[model samples]
Target: MPTFTALTTLADGEKARALAESMEEMDPTPDGVGVFEMEDGSGLWEVGGYFTEAPDEVALSLLAAAYGARPFAVSELPDTDWVAKVRRELVPVQAGRFFVYGSHDADKVPEDCVPLLIEAAMAFGTGHHGTTLGCLRALDRLMNAGIEARNVADIGCGTAVLAMAAAHVWPRPVLASDIDPVAVEVAEANAAVNGLSEKVICVEAAGFDHPTLAAAAPFDLVFANILKGPLIDLAPSMAESTAKGGHVILSGLLVEQAEEVIAVYSAAGYSLAHREDIVDWSTLTMRRE
Candidate 1:
């Protein structure tokens, strides 16, 4: 497959969603931006966000229409070389002591992470975003605190990044869940790569929806890295699945969005523990009181 990106200077507005849904046929936007890649030879198109100062409708639509005028040049990838390119493009990053690497980058990742290489094609939590980094750091804090959790859940598992981190952080059994099946597949592969297949369970479900999550009873720790709206909506699920005195780590919200998310948990008897800010994103560690 060849990917071409389209750049659009559509500032923060309702137009953003409209522009995104317009290109739904092409490919789903990645990283929650106006960015979309051509799944086939269609070529990559990234709507590079325009400056907020972009001119009125006439100019905006003109640029938007013009991008499609030129042939999107698609790059050819050799089947054998795909792994090498993904690793080079999305370099493995280390947050605190946790490491994020592509399945192909397993050999390149520092030995400390126990190296879990999720396949290159896997989307979502590829470990490139601040949300993933923030989550890793938050997970590390739990390990550093010496909190022992026999049961853990990583909701919205997104490539099972947090679940893989949890397996490395503790000897406990961790259950990973994501609404996307591809994420589940990659997560399962990652678990095996990290030598944690036996310790971590990957499921195709949403926010602890699987029977294993239910069978495990209330978990000692839970990790959720979904957006503010979904996070708030699923607050009850997380609260219910967490043991009375266990803990929950929340991420994937902006600094301004944290208060509302925190409010949801705080009302449910979770007392805040530590707050980590990476870029403008925030992740909070809270314990069930």
Candidate 2:
């Protein structure tokens, strides 16, 4: 079956989110909608929707106009084996000592690096994106610094690649949680494929809301690769959940927004330990003291 996509851009995050929400109520509603900050540092937010059927161009245009966004660009995607295409195109990504690959590239995994099998699917964090890559590199730096984390949590973990990477080095269970249940399932599958099902526990929760996460309080290390808004909002909770002298790795924000995030975390009792900028994304490692 053919698929369709409609995309628009606006300067305001609120409008972009509102426009994406409105796409959900449209006739021939989208299978999914997303609002993401453009990494170009244009202060633009992209709102996009995907549909199994052709989306209503007129409705999309109207929504864009209402939201003060650019005209919606709608396209009909060619019918093809998207999964196979992804598998063929997404080569294994290496960050520091970690290697992220799909089942298709299983043979390409290096014996010297930590291998994390993340099948090309609906979830995020395959380590190809700059955000995930930066996070992995930051984690590797921490490991190289002789930091040992007995307890770890990966909040908003998509494929749980980061959690699995930590599990590969630390002899402890790594808690991985995501707001989306589908992501949680993907994380579990990825962990199983990486032979880390026992070490990387997956759960569905927003930030640190789950009882399982709450019970495992004061994590030695935490990974939050979510967006800037959620990261800022999570500062206080992150500080509370992190043990003294623990570490937090944050990403999914543009490089330009790093200072703002740092300031917020600083107020929450976190001091920046390391910062790595890859392309347009910035990954921050903060120490709780």
Candidate 3:
């Protein structure tokens, strides 16, 4: 079956959400509607709808005008085997000491690297994206420096790959938390697949808001591969949750925005230790003072 999508962006988040809500009531109503803030620090909200049938473009245009948004770009998605495509295209990624691969590429893992199994169809942070890859490399650097972390936390952990990596190197339980319940579930499943189920504890929470993460506060190492805004918002909490002299590895930022994030964390009592840039993304490793 063919699928269709209609998407647009608006500067106002409330208006974008209202537009998405209205799209749910349209004829040939969307199977799903979503509103999300753009992660690039654009201050724009994206509103989108997915449909089994083609959406009415005129109606979408009118709705966009009503919401003061750009015209919706409607497109029909091809009926393709996404999983097969992913399996064929998503090759194994090697970041320093870690190797992230799907089960289909199980035989490709090199003997010298630590293996982390995350299916291509699973949640984000598969180590394919630059942000996740940078974080993995940052962790590898810390390990090479002989840093021993007794407690670690992976905030906004999509598939718990970072948490699992920490568990693989350190003989300690690592806390992994995400705001999305589905992501938390995927994280748990990935942990099990990596045989780190006991070592990587997954939870559903935003930032450090959960009791389990709070109780496990003062982490020796922290990973937050989320976007720029959330990273800024998380600095104070990150400072509080991280132990003095502990390290926090952060990514999901454009190269231009890395300076801004560095400033925020610096104000929160963190000093930049190392930075690596992959393509257009930047990953920062900072030490809590």
Off by more than 4 A, model 1: 1-85, 103-114
lDDT of 3 at 14: 85
TM-score per prediction, in order, is 0.70, 0.90, 0.95
Q: Number of the top candidate by lDDT?
A: 3
lDDT of 2 by residue, 1-289 (tens): 9889898899999888988888999999899999888766688999999999989898888898899999998999999997878877889999999988888888999999988888876436789899999999999999899999999999999888899999999999999999999889988998888899999999999999999999999899999999888999999899999999999999998889999999999999999999989888899999999
Residue-level lDDT of model 1, residues 1-289, one tens digit each, is 3333344533333444555555443323332235433222233334443222222334435445644433222223233565555656877777778766665556677755545455666645866777887877777777777877888899888778788777876787788988878778888877776688898888898776788889996988888888776788888888888999898888888888899888999998899998888888888899998
The reply for model 2, stretches above 4 Å from the true place, is 10-21, 37-45, 65-69
Better of 1 and 2 by TM-score: 2
RMSD of each: 8.4, 2.2, 1.5
lDDT of candidate 2 vs native? 0.91
Write the residue-wise lDDT of candidate 3 on 185-216 in tens digits: 99999998888888999999999999999899
- Deviation (Å) of 149 in candidate 3: 1.0
Count of residue pairs whose backbone atoms collide, per candidate: 18, 0, 0
Better of 1 and 3 by lDDT: 3
